[model samples]
Target: MRRVPRWALLSSGCAPVVLTGGWVVAGRLEGGSYDPATQTISVLAADGAAGAWVMTAALVALGLCHLVTAWALRPAALPGRVALGCGGVAALVVALFPAPSSGGSLQHGSVAAVGFALLAVWPVLAFDPDGRAPWGLRRVPCFAATAVMGAGAVWFLIEIQGHGAIGAAERFVTFVQSVWPFMVVASCVRHKRPAESRL
Candidate 1:
């Protein structure tokens, strides 16, 4: 089996950090009225908001990290890698099309939905059924992970329809999506063959 590279691990690990840090910093800079429970992260990057660049830069970095992780995950199936990379590109597109402060933009919502769906489904698509794959890439775990992400996405959509904590639901789904690559990379690194130690 091909081993995961150190750079992939680094990039994947940085994704959640960059996202959380960006939100915290943006929230701090914006001050007082920003409620994480009800508001979306994109609000931080909306037009005319203070510290918008912080969130924008974070989104760009997060997308690039996803692309890098996809490239580094050579052991996974090709279609899965393509889906992951395309998801990353969708994230970058989301950054490009920020929503307005008061309401959502159709383009931004479309790209964000695409990104969420791709990220949620990639794991299941990446799963190896041969039973020789790393722990994170195994069929059962991948299916479970995808199911959980799908549930979170449903909750987020319901929240968008004015049912519950929209910010919390979004954060839960996005944080999982951001962290999953790192888990997969770690599993690959842990199961590395003796001959592939250099990776």
Candidate 2:
């Protein structure tokens, strides 16, 4: 019922924020392992398999969100939209790709990275806040710190709720990438709305 600006941004204006959130959460949902027994389809621990499903669903939703946002906008806004949407799609692709044995080599290729990229890009692309960049050393670093703290809070909330599926680092990433930005964007929408991206 609420015609929130957040909806406007996602459904029309800068859409990367929403897409990235979905993708990041999706990555967190993925569960995988190296199943040497089958010698096929890679393998991971039980939790990995479960996480994969969650991540997959989230990514699929994110992909759909990107598609909707991509087509909804005018041609004038295509470039930024493309960047944002591509980031989400790429995150999904990265997420679906098999992990290395050590799970170290391509960690940067994770969905969170794509989400982070989108968050970092949206303000500049949209210039949401009187057509100027929202992030400076101060605003961005403060927000980043807030995001880190928020993620820790989520980690604690998960423990309180007994929904412990993700590792601490993974939980932190989830909080920072998905929940934190989601909240920040909402705050921006409520008070600042979106601004034109600066040149």
Which regions in candidate 2 have their CA more than 4 angstroms from the true location?
1-48, 73-77, 100-102, 107-115, 128-199
Q: How accurate is candidate 2 locally (lDDT)?
A: 0.42
| TM-score result, candidate 2 | 0.42
lDDT of 1 at 90: 89
Q: Write the per-residue lDDT of candidate 2 for residues 1-199, one digit (tens) a residue.
A: 1123345356433333443454344434442432222211122312256444544455455555554544433221334456556755754665466455444435534544555456345423432233322332124543455456556555544653563533443434433433333343344444431333332
Against the reference, the lDDT scores of all candidates come to 0.89, 0.42
Q: Per-residue lDDT of 1-199 in model 1, one digit per residue for the tens? A: 7778878899899999998898889888889888888988998999977979999989999999999999999888777788889888988998899888887799999899999999999998888786768898999888888999999999999998994689899999999999998999899888856556566
Query: All predictions: root-mean-square deviation over Cα?
Result: 2.4, 10.2
Task: State candidate 1's TM-score.
Answer: 0.94
- Which stretches of model 1 miss by more than 4 angstroms? 193-199
Query: Which ten residues in a row are the worst by lDDT in model 2?
Result: 37-46
When summed lDDT is taken over every stretch of 10 residues in candidate 1, the lowest stretch is: 190-199
